[model samples]
Target: MDIGVGFEITYAARRAQRLSNVVLAKARTHTAESIDCER
Candidate 1:
């Protein structure tokens, strides 16, 4: 039971990490575009 719980926690952490990375990438792209537009 403990091992199963550990696996679930790790899986959740991985999913959260992926989601944050995707959001970070999109934010960076948006910032770059806005900066280009300013020029």
Candidate 2:
């Protein structure tokens, strides 16, 4: 039971990491677009 719980936690952490990376990438793209519009 403990092992199963640990596995779930690790999976969740990995998923969260991936989601944050995607969000960061989107934010960067949006920022670049806004900068281009200003010019």
Candidate 3:
């Protein structure tokens, strides 16, 4: 149980979570654009 290692792990996890959120938002935006085109 090292302090630096624990901090790195937490930071990496946070970065990954943020990236996933960005990707999901982009996908939803694309879907909305397609739906708008259809209408």
Candidate 4:
């Protein structure tokens, strides 16, 4: 039971990391586009 709970927590952390990475990528892309537009 403890192992299962630990696995669940690790899985959740990995998923959250992936989500944050995606959000960072999107924000970077948006910033680049805005800068290009300004030029």
Backbone collision count in every prediction? Answer: 0, 0, 0, 0
Which of 2 and 4 is ahead in TM-score?
4
Cα-based TM-score, every candidate = 0.92, 0.93, 0.91, 0.95
Model 1 per-residue lDDT tens digits across residues 1-39: 599999999999999999999999999999999999999
Q: How far out, in Å, is residue 6 in model 3?
A: 0.5
Ranked candidates (TM-score, high to low): 4, 2, 1, 3
lDDT of 2 by residue, 1-39 (tens): 599999999999999999999999999999999999999
Residues 8-30 of candidate 4: C-alpha lDDT, one tens digit per residue = 99999999999999999999999
What candidate 1 gets wrong by more than 4 Å, as runs, is none
Specify the poorest-scoring 10-residue window by lDDT in model 3.
11-20
As a whole number from 0 to 100, the lDDT of residue 16 in candidate 4 is 100
Q: List the residue pairs that clash in candidate 2.
A: none
lDDT by residue (tens digit), candidate 3, 1-39: 999999999999999999999999999999999999999
Write down the TM-score for model 2.
Answer: 0.93
Off by over 4 Å in 3: none
Distance from true location, Cα of 34 in model 2, Å: 0.4
